[model samples]
Target: MRMVFRWFGEGNDQVPLQHIKQIPGVEGIVWALHDIPAGEPWPTDRIKEVKQQADQFGFHIDVVESVNIHEDIKLGLPTRDKYIKHYITTIKRLAEVGVKVVCYNFMPVFDWTRTELFEKLGDGSTALFFDNEKIKDIDPMELVEKISSNTSVTMPGWEPERLKSLAKLFEQYEHVTEENLWSNLQYFLEKVIPVAEQHDVKLAIHPDDPPWSVFGLPRIMKNRDDVERLLNLVSNPYNGLTMCSGAFGADPKNNVPDMVNEFIDRIHFAHIRNVKNKGNKSFIETSHRASDGSVDICDVVKAYHENGFTGYARPDHGRHIWDEKCRPGYGLYDRALGIMYLWGIWDSLERSKKVEA
Candidate 1:
């Protein structure tokens, strides 16, 4: 497995590219143009600016965490065609910049939701948290305020403009069901996957954050079966999965290592992190160490090694350690630690192979 780090960009992130390059096995950055709104063409000049910056620091800008999908596309609105065309244009530009995989999601309004940004753990470090009972009782708008209150850094899914119309978006999805979401996602894949194939870039869809419905919003990409169905919907190698462990692990039923083994060939990107489930559909992020969390991260890594996975892998969400004032889940200290932990596993596997030979 090839390791990469997630960098938000020059001024937008607290962790700089130099720090990322210092991590032992990290060879690239999983990034995107966050300032640009969804459905807009990613300007070539903007892409070049990022490339130039990464080049200065000696890191590849090949895999993007996301090119955010517009609500119009997910809702299947009349204006979706225009947005999709713009999306196609963006893909073409990304290909020009040597991007190999473009990760995007088809979730309606909110891309991911959490009740608390910093739920303190036993070690005094904090992590992103989701309380199921509280989520059911609280209003999404209130939760939005709680999450976005820290304006120091930009949250991926909860953009200010989108959250402004939380009620309206919810109302729009009144009639939309799980089947509707699946159909809309299929529509999106049909149009874009061909372009992706032509450009030699893979279109990877990130699974829903919690792998379940939230605030009555229909979430289709929730489990392995859902991923299987999605892959078959387009039935092309270009159409792939991001294979996020934290997201899929929230559902106890999802065996991440098994999913990795089954979908190994089609997975182009991976977000490997650990979360400790609290039972009854609740979970909290934890250290990337396998024993600390619900997911068997060791088995997940071994499965990738056994499958000969050479795709990009990055440590997903990490605890806020050392009083690091950074993005909620994307902090430097713990994530850097997570990288070393992963490297330990990879190094061990390589040695064992050498001994056998």
Candidate 2:
């Protein structure tokens, strides 16, 4: 597996490429034009600017976290065609810049949901935590206000501009059922996948955070079965997955390593992190070590290692360790430490193979 780091941008991200460069085995940055709104065509000039920035640090701009799908497309509205055209344009430009995988999600309204961004653990370090009861009881707007006001850096899924019309967005989704959402996603892939295939770019859909319905939003990409359905929906290699262990592991039934092996061919990117299942559909993000979390991260790493995975991988989310004041899960210290832990597991597996040979 090729290791990549998620870098927001020069001014946007607190963690710099200089620091990320120090992490062993990291090959590139998993990035996107975060300032660009969903469905808008990503400017070619801006794309090239990001390329130049990555080139400075000898990092490939190979994977984008998202080219966000517009709500019009998700709701299957008539105006979706315009947005789809813009998405296609963006995809073609990203391919031109050598971006092999574009990671996107189909989760309705919110891309992901959490009760608290910095829930304290026993170690006094903070990590992203989800409380099942809190989400059910909390008002969506209050949750948005709580999260948006907490951090200046825009969180990946909770874009402030979209949430401004929280009431309206919820209204739009009132009539959208699971089946309707699935059909909408299929419609999107049918149009976009062919273009991605032609340009040698893989459209890797990220699993829903918590991997289930949150606040009544339909989350289709949850487990192995959902992945099977997704692959069959568009039977092309370019139409792939960014299998996130933390997302899938939220539900204890999901065998993350098993799923990794099962979908090896179509998994274009990997977000390898650990999540401690807190029962009743709740989970907390943990360090990348297998021992720290419920997910067997060692086995997950081995699953990819044995397959000789060539796809992009990143240590997905991490705790805010060392009292570091940074983005909730995308902190510098813990993630850097997580990288070493991942490298340690992978290298040992490699050594074992060599010894056997």
Candidate 3:
């Protein structure tokens, strides 16, 4: 596995490239054009700028966390073709700078939902938390309010422009069912995946966070069968998955390690973070350690190694430790520590294989 880090660029993130360089095994940055809204084609000049910055630190910008798909594409609106053209343009531009994998999601309105951004843990360190029951009772507006309350840090999925127009966005999806979502996603893949192939860029769809419906929005990328259907739909090696443990682990039955082993061939990117299942479809992001969360992170990491995974991997969503005033899950301390923890497992696996040889 080639380790990567997620950096929000120069001013946007508190964790600097200098700090990320200090991490033992990280080789790249999973990044995006944050200021650009969905549906806009990222300018080639801007892509080059990010490339220059990463090159300065000797980190590859080979993986982009998202090139946010316009809601129109997900809704299959008449204007989708226009937006999809923009998306294709962006993909070609990213490829110019050596980006091999582009990670994105198909969840409507919100990309990922959570009730609290900083839930206090037993160790006094805080982490992103979700309470499923609480979500059902609360209004989507209230949840947005809570998530957006952190004005200093921009939440990944909850872009201000989208949040400001929530009512219209929800109304647009009011008629969209699970099947509709699947159809729309297939339509998107059919259009973009071919272009991605032309550019030699792997289009990796991130699994829906929580791996279930939120706010009654249709969620199709939630499980193993869902992934199976996705691969079959596109039927291209470049059309792949960004298998995230925390997202799938929300459902206790996900069998994350098995997923790593089963879909090893098509998983182009990996987000290896652990989450403690809070019961009844709720989970909280936790330390990458196996004991700290429900996911068997060691087994998951080992599975990746055994499968000969040379693709991009990252230690996703670390807790905010040492009173660090950083992005909730993108903190430097816990994630840097998580990298060492992951490397410890990966290196030991390598040693065992050498001994066997």
Candidate 4:
């Protein structure tokens, strides 16, 4: 596995590139042009600017966390073709700069949702939490304000501009169902995947954050069968998945290691983090250690090793530790710690293989 760190560019992030480079096994940054709005083609100069900054720190910007798909694309609106053209252009530019994988999602309205950003954990370190009961009761607008209120850096799924049209977005999806979402996603893949293949870049769709429906929004990519169906929708290597342990693990039914072994070839990137599942469709982010969370992170790592996975992977959402105030889930200390945990697993697997041989 090639480990990368998600650096949200200079000024926008508290953790700098130098700090990321100091992490032992991290060789690259998973990045994007955050200031650029979704559906707009990213400028070549801007992409190069990020590349130059990572170069200065001696790190490769090989994976992009997202080139966010517009709601028009997800809703299958008439204007989707224009946004798709812009997306295709962006893909070509990213590939020109040696980006091997582009991690994007097709979830409508919100990219991911949670009732609370800093739910207090037993250990005093806080984590991103989801309360099933509370989510059912709370208004999504209030939740949006809660998530986007304190930070200058844009949260991944809760883009400020998109949330502004919450009422309209919700109304747009009123008639849409799970099947509609799947068809729309397939439409998007058909248009974008060929361009991705031409550019030698794989489009890795991140699974729905909780791997279930929220606020009555239809979520299709929530299980192994969903992932399999998606891969077969386009039937191309460039059309793939960004298999996230924390997202899929929320479901409890998803065996992440087994999925990794099954879908190894289609996995272009991975978000290896852990979550402690609470009963009845609720979970909270936990330390990346296998014992702390529901997902068997060691087995996940070992599966990757056995499969000879050389694809890019990163420590996903982490706890807000050491009083290091930053983005809710994208803090430095815990993620750095998570990386060490992952490295420990990978190293042990390598040694075990040698011993067995």
Candidate 5:
């Protein structure tokens, strides 16, 4: 497995590429033009700007976290065609900059939901927490305010401009069911996957965080069966998954290692993080250590190593350790620590193979 670090960009992220470069095994940056809104075509010059930044640090910009899907595309509106046309152009441009995999999600209304941005852990370090009970009671707008109030940066999926029409977006989705979401997603993949294949870019969809519905929004990409159905929807090698462990592992039903084994080939990019399930669909992001959270991260890495995974893998969301004043989960300290933990497990696996041989 090849390691990469997600950097929001020069100005948007607190973590610098130099700091990312210091991480032992990280060879690339998982990035995107965060300033650009969803559905808009990413400008060629803007794409080149990020390339120049990564090039300066000798980091390959192989994977982009998203070219976010517009709500029109998800809602299956006629205006979607216009946005999709723009999306196709963006893909072609990203290909020019050497991006290999593009990760995007289809979670309606909200990309990922959480009650508390920083809930204290036993170690006194804080992490992103999801309170299942509170989510049901809290208003979506109130949740939006809560998230916005905490972070200076615009949280992905919870962008203010997008949420401006929050009630309208929810009203539009009132009639849209899970099946409708699946159909809309299929419509999207059919148009873009071919372009992705032609440009040698794999389109990877991140599973819904929490792997379940939030605020009564329809969530189709939530579990093993959901992932299986999505892959089968297009049935092409270019059509792939981002394979986020924290999202899938939060659900006790998902055997993460088993899922890794089954879908390793289809996984083009991996988000390897851990989440401790608090029960009844709530979880808090934890350090990447296998024992620290419910996910068997050690075995998950071993599965990828044993499968000879050549794709990009990144240490996903981590605790806000060391009093780091940074993006909620994109902090440098814990993620760097997490990467080392992953390397520890993977390097040991390699040595064990050698000893066995």
Candidate 6:
């Protein structure tokens, strides 16, 4: 596995590329033009600029976390074609700059939902928490306020412009059902996957955060069967999955290692984080260590190793350890620790394979 770190950009992220470079085994950055709104074509110059920065640090910009999908595309609105045309242009440009994978999600209204960004754990370190019962009672607007209140660092899915028209956005999804979402997603993949294939860029769709619907929104990418249907829908190597453990682990039914084994080839990027399933559809992101969370992270890595995975992997959301005043889940300390844990597993596996030989 080729490990990468997620860096928001020069001015946006608290963690610097130099710090990321210090992490052993991290070779690249998973980045995005966060200032750009969804649906618009990314400026080629801006893409080159980010690449230049990474080049300065001697890190490859091989993967981008998101090129946010416009609500128009998800809702299958009349204007979707226009946005999709722009998306194709963005993909072509990213490929030109050596980006191999683009990770995005189809979660409506919100990309990921959480009741608390900093729920203090027993160790006094805080992590992103999701309470199943609490989410049902909380008002969507109130949740939006809680997540968006901090204006310094922009949340990926909860952009200010999108939330400014929250009521209207919800209205657009009023008639969208799960089937509608699947059809629209298929429509999107059909148009873009070919372009991605032509440019050697893999379009990786991140599973719905929590792997379930939130706030009455339809979520189609939530379970193993859902992924089976998704891969079959497009049936192309270029159309793939991001294979996020924390997202799928929220649903206890998802055996993350098995999913890794089954779709190993189709998975172009891996978000290897752990989540302690709190039962009844609630979870909290945890340390990448196997004992700290419910997901068997070791087995997950073994599946990838056993399957001969050579794709990009990154340490996903981590605890806000060491009193780090950073983005809710994108803190540097715990994630760097997570990377070492993963490297330990991967290295041990490699040694065992050589011994067998």
lDDT of 2 by residue, 1-357 (tens): 889999999899999899899888888999988989888999999999999999998999999999999999999999999999999999999989898899999988798888889999889998999999899899999999999888999788888778888899998988789899999999999999999999999999999887888888887888899999999999999999999999999999999999989999999999999988888988899889899999999999999998889889999899998888898899989988989999999889999999999
Tens-place lDDT digits, model 4, residues 254-336 = 99999999999999999999999998888899999999999999999989999999999999999998899899899999999
Estimate candidate 3's alpha-carbon lDDT, on a 0 to 1 scale.
Answer: 0.92
User: Which number leads on lDDT?
Assistant: 6
Assess the local accuracy of residue 44 in candidate 6 as a C-alpha lDDT between 0 and 100: 94
Candidate 4 minimal-lDDT segment of 10 residues:
148-157
TM-score of each: 0.99, 0.99, 0.99, 0.98, 0.99, 0.99
Which residue pairs clash in candidate 4? Answer: none
lDDT value, candidate 2, whole model: 0.91
Colliding pairs, model 5: none
Models, CA RMSD each? 0.8, 0.8, 0.8, 0.9, 0.7, 0.8
Which model is ahead, 4 or 5, in terms of TM-score?
5
Clashing pairs in 2: none
Q: Tell me the RMSD of model 2 versus the true structure.
A: 0.8
- After superposing all C-alphas onto the true structure, candidate 6 shows an RMSD in angstroms of 0.8
lDDT of each: 0.92, 0.91, 0.92, 0.91, 0.92, 0.93
How well does candidate 4 score on lDDT at residue 269? 97
Judge candidate 1 against the unseen true structure and give its global Cα lDDT, from 0 to 1: 0.92
